[model samples]
Target: MSEKDQRIQTGKFGEDAACDYLIEADYKIVERNWRCRSGEIDIIADDAGRLVFIEVRTRKTGGRFGTAAESVDRRKQQQVRDTAQVYLRSIGCSAESIRFDVIAITMSRQMDSILEYKHYEGAF
Candidate 1:
């Protein structure tokens, strides 16, 4: 596969792994790849009755770019907020108890082992 294809495949696998990790951690997944004109949310879940919007970032290595969470900059945060608004409107969910989360997955050199997964709740 091409480099881009490999990256995409790795991303999908990472997201799936993140979802599984969330489920195991007691989060109820509500949506995956929820998109709007503004942007996209990788995962939507319920955490103890609160609405949780998750942004999953997967990286082959973190040394060069710093870390996966570093990728979600101001512009990306705005897009996530906009998409969350759309999601709230569609599901009639109140923004009061809603939270934004970031799931950063780092892979090892072999690309087969997960080096780390950092979950930052109430990120935005």
Candidate 2:
């Protein structure tokens, strides 16, 4: 596989892993890869009656870029917020008690091995 293909595969694997982790943590997944004109949301779930908008970032190596959570900058946060707004409007959900979360998946050399996962609640 090409480098790009490998990276894509890694990302998909990481997203799947993150979904599994969320499910294990008792999060009810409402959607995945939700897109609007503003931006895209990787995962949408409900955590104990609170709507959670999750951004999943996966990295094979975390040396230069730090962790996945750090990858979400201000612009990215704004995009997520916009996307979440669209989602809420489309689903007729009240924006009262919503939260933004970042799920960082770090992979090891083995590809299948999860080196670390950090879940940042209310990241934005």
Candidate 3:
């Protein structure tokens, strides 16, 4: 596969893993790949009574760029926040508590298997 294809696969794998992880943790997944004019939310879940917006970042381990978690910088955070607002408005639901979470997955470059998975709650 081409490098781009590999990257896409890696991302999908990470998202799948993240969803499974959330389910195991008793989070009710509300949406996946939710898109709006502002941006896209990788996952939207209900964690107990609070609304959780999740960003899933995947990267190959030992990559020169940086870790997957590091990729969700200030700009990305802002975008997610804005999109969350849009989502809430569209749903006509007011959430008393909202949280931003990041699920970073690092996969082995040689094996395409996850080497690490990090979950950052209230990340931003």
Candidate 4:
């Protein structure tokens, strides 16, 4: 596969792993790949009545760019925040609590299998 295709596959794998992890942890997934004018939120979940906006980052271990978690920089955080605002307005429902979370996954480059995973709650 091409590099782009590989990257896309890696991303999907990470998101899938994140979802499974959330489910196992008893988080109800509300949406995936939620998109609006601002940008896309990788996942939206309900965590004990609180609304959570999640960003999933995936990369192979030891990538030159950076670790998966480090990838979610200030600019990306702002985008997620902006999109979350729009999402809230669109829903028109008052949330008891709202938060931003990030799920970072690292895979074995050769194995294409998850090697490490981290979930940051209230990341922003």
Best by lDDT: 3
lDDT for each residue of candidate 2 in 1-124, tens digit (9 for 90 to 100): 9989987898789889989999999999999999989989999999999999999999876457677778899999999999899999999988999999999988986686888889999888
Candidate 3: lDDT over CA atoms?
0.93
lDDT string, candidate 3, 15-120, tens digits: 9999999999999999999999899999999999899999999988789989999999999999999999999999997756999999999888774578999999
The global C-alpha lDDT for each of the candidates, from Candidate 1 onward, is 0.90, 0.90, 0.93, 0.91
Q: What range of 10 consecutive residues in model 1 has the weakest lDDT sum?
A: 59-68
lDDT string, candidate 1, 17-112, tens digits: 999999999999999999888888999999999989999999887457678889989999989999999999998877999999999999986688
- Pairs that clash in candidate 4: none
Error of 3 at 3 (Å): 2.6
lDDT of 2 at 103: 90
Ranking by lDDT: 3, 4, 1, 2
- Candidate 4 weakest lDDT stretch, 10 residues: 88-97
| Model 2, global lDDT | 0.90
Query: Clashing residue pairs, candidate 2?
Result: none
**Model 3, which residues run further than 4 Å from truth?**
none
Clashes per model (N, Cα, C within 3 A): 0, 0, 0, 0
